[model samples]
Target: MTEKIAVLGAGSWGSMLAAILNENGHEVQLWTRSAAQADELNQKHTNRAYIQNYTFPENLRASTDLETVLTGATEILFIVPAQATRAVATEVDRILAKLGQRPALIHGSKGLETTTHLRVSQILAETISPEHRTSISVISGPSHAEGVVKHDPTLVTVASDDFDAAQRFQHLFMNDYFRVYTNADVIGVEFGGALKNIIALASGALAGLGYGDNARAALMTRGVAEISRLGVSFGANPLTFAGLSGMGDVIVTATSTNSRNYRAGYQLGQGVPLADVVANMGMVIEGIATSQSAYELAQTTGISMPITEAIHAVLEQEETVETAIHHLMTREGQAENG
Candidate 1:
């Protein structure tokens, strides 16, 4: 029952999935671009740069060889940062074509490219042919790798336009500690997955300002509204926002102590420079890129997303948190539902 699985990134999230899949009796191969890191994981059984405590599972292997990873991998999980996704996907496609085999693809990263403003699934569709489309799935939600790696109970949604691929992905991920659900709304899933990080940054800003639950609650609720609105504009089902990938993800990211975006924002709110905050966090904060993409998408679609705009402003340091709040609160009045 062991399946050949390849993870394309060896960051924290990638290493976590490699461990989880290995625990599930899968042949897991974790690929990192850094040969030094790969050698360390192969010899030390640990990813010293990311997850420090646990040794990699015995069945899990690490390598810098992309061809070796793709040739034998029947299912490949793409876990690189969102900005790097396209390059990695293109490389993977070329490697797979060279091998004359197409494997199922799963992306665990969240965020759209700021320059292209394309969702991960859309980028994948463009990179791979329709014949390979059925093999793509997106697995995302509130599940943080830090929690999941420790065997905490976490739930996430795996979505594909293709139903059978969703089911197959569900089987690959579901376990006693990890619960997997299936949905066909790939657009909404991807949007919610990316947008929540931006909102979490806003939530952290509010928390750092010593704002009460009222502020956090408002940010979370209205944040979901904006996310859902923008998602529906992209042809995603409006209902997916209420599911695991949307509201569920927002809650976890906005409130959790482990969220990198939230932590970055908290420091920003406490008067730290954005560059310093990111440097101190020592992780890729997807929200920083996602905020620009959301702002651009909102402008293109003529959709109103004040919260995302506020986050964008703060990110650019165009306006302080106080000014951003004042702008939001004193904006022209409209009906609550409008």
Candidate 2:
């Protein structure tokens, strides 16, 4: 069945999803605040700012008007950065008030709100009332926009507290090239997607510092321990971390150059200033922000997250990468499974 879908945010991920939906023969309206971007997508069938020189499917529509985009839409997908989720969700709530319909909500963004440290799904839950939406779901994994747009074999998980909602999204995005898996562990899936970015930052920094794959392998292994430790503390299923949103995402983000967090960390390792690294990236380096939030969270939870703390120190405390690495190396030894 062809469904009317409203996709918020016109960044790489948003455009990628819209194009896929269009290819799936769904009616998709890709929404952005910039009128210029909307016109470009509608007229040129491209979003050069995010994905350069690549053309989008002609059937995909773009709009600056939230009302027009949300009107009669069955699904509203948010692909905005985590920090921007609340504001965008608030706007969506206002528009939905007029339409008097609660569409199934889905978000593909990964990361936590700065001070609140709330996940993207949490922000949506706070902003959009249960009465104003059918259910909320999060889609996350190792898939990157650049890879998915080219029809590369990609898999991701669709998670929700509601099983039916999860299956609905699973069916929505499933295709030959893109596989969707259903998961009921929303907490595990969301946190896995968010925390792995910090690990990728550390991985990139290690690579930039001329460390070999051995060091990265060690970091990734330890990073999984940290992620699982913190995740289980939050009532997440342990096995969920072994799945796509966890180990699967960490592998790609930490190893691939296409990962913004990895690239940003590499620049940091090369002694590029954090400000310079972000400015050069021309994209939101989510791990930079998530590091701080995760550090704060780990502290409050009284969980051990040395890797997370190392990345946080480098990003926020002006600690040199060398000093952070030294601190991490000198930490008291413990059992690997501890």
Candidate 3:
């Protein structure tokens, strides 16, 4: 069955997803905050700033009017930054309230709300009114927008508290080039998606500092261990950390040049200022804020996450990346599982 899908946000990921949905035979309305971006997409069928050298489908329309986009949509995908999810949800809630429409909510953003340490889905539930809050789902994995735009073979997980909703999204997104899996472990899936970014930042920093393959391997392995420990504290299945959103995401984001967090960490490892790295990238480095939230969560839960703590110190405190690495290496030796 064909569906009208409203994709909120016009960043690289959002635009790529909108294009994919259009290719899947869905009517996709991509809503952006910038009228100029909307005009560019409509007029040129391209978003050169975000996804250069690529063109969107002619049927994939772009709009700045929220009400117009939401009016007849059957599903809404929120792909904005984590910090902005609440505000956008609030706006969607208000518009839905007036329009008397309820659409399935899907969020593709990966990060915890720094202030409340809530997952994007949790923030969505809180901001959107109960009546307008339909089934909520998250689509996450090692999939990167750059690769997805190029139609590279990709696998991802769609998790939800609602099983049917997860299946719906899985069916909607799965295709020859993209594979989707459904999992009911929302907590684990979201944690795996958000926490892996922190590890990727560390891995990128190690590479930036001229570390060899062994060091990167150690970081990736121990990084997932700590991530699993912290995730278990939050009632997430430890096995989920071993799956696509977990191990798969960590490997790709940590190693790929397409990851903004990795690039940011690379610059940081090279002794570049954080502000300069962010300004030059012109994209959100989610791991920076996620590291802070994970560090705080670990402290509150009494879980020992030394890697997260080290990354947080390097990012938030004036601690040098070299010193942070030294501190981690000098920590007391323990069992591999301990």
Candidate 4:
């Protein structure tokens, strides 16, 4: 059955997901905060702001009006930046409550908001009614919008506390080019999705420093250790760290040139200032906020995440990358055990 889907945000990932849903025969309403962009999509069938090369499907409609997007929206897929999720959720909550029904939600944003230090789903629950919590799902994986727009084969995960919702999203979005898997460990999935961006930045920094495969491999492996240790402290399943949202996402984002975090780190490693790096990237590199939240989360949870700490020092505290590296290298050694 064709479902009415609302994709909020008209950025690369949002446009790509809208295209995917439209191709799947669902009625898709892709919303843009910018009225100009929304008009362009309606007129040109393309999002000039992000996915400039590809055309949106004919079945895909767009609007700048939030209410229009919410009209008959059975499921809301939020593709906004991580920092904007809370504000968007707040807006959605107010409107949805007035409507007297809540749609299932799928957040595609990755990273924890620095101020709140809450994952996307947590932010949703906090902004919306608690009764709506179980209806939230997260779709995550190694998906990069650059590839997904081209109809490239990509694997993603749909995770929720509600197994039925997970399976529903799996069926809703999965396609020959896009494969979706369902995982019931909501916290673990969200944590892995949010935290791995930090690791990607570290790996990008390593690659930016002219480090080879061995260095990136070491960073990726150790990054998982740091993320898993932190997640375990917060009641997440340790094994989830080894799954798609964890190791899988880390590998893809850290190594790929298309990843905003990796690209930002690459420039940073190449001696660009943080501000310059961010300005040049031209998209939201979630790792910036994730790095901040990871540091705060580690300190709050008493988890010793040296890598996350280093990233925090470099990005937030404006510590030199050299200084951060030296600090990491000089850490005291301990036995590797549970």
Query: What lDDT score goes with residue 257 in model 2?
Result: 93
2 versus 4: better lDDT goes to = 2
lDDT, candidate 4, at 335: 64
Tens digit per residue, CA lDDT, model 1, 224-265: 999999999989999999989999999999998789988888
Overall lDDT per candidate, in order of appearance:
0.88, 0.92, 0.91, 0.85
TM of each candidate vs. truth: 0.96, 0.98, 0.98, 0.96
Compared with the true structure, model 2 gives a TM-score of 0.98
Model 3 TM: 0.98
| Candidate 1 TM-score to native | 0.96
After best superposition, candidate 3 residue 223: deviation in angstroms? 0.9
Per-residue lDDT tens digits for candidate 3, residues 1-338, read: 99999999999999998888889999999999999999999999999888888988998899999999998899999999998999999999999999999899999999999969999999999999779967999999998889987789999999999999999999888899999999988898999999999998998889899998899889999999998998888889999999999999999999998898888889888988888888988888899889889989998999999999999999885589999999999999999988
Model 3 RMSD vs true structure: 0.9
As a whole number from 0 to 100, the lDDT of residue 304 in candidate 3 is 91
Q: Across residues 1-338, which tens digit of lDDT does each residue of candidate 2 receive?
A: 98999999999988998888888889999889899999999999989888976898887889998889999999999999999999999989988887798899999998989999898888999999887899999999998889986789999999999999999988889899999999999999999999999999999999899999889999998998899999899889999999999999999999999899999999999999998998999989999889889999999999999999989889885689989999989989899897
Better of 1 and 2 by lDDT: 2
lDDT of 4 by residue, 3-70 (tens): 89989988888889888888888999998888888888888887776765887776678888888888
Worst lDDT 10-window in candidate 2: 310-319
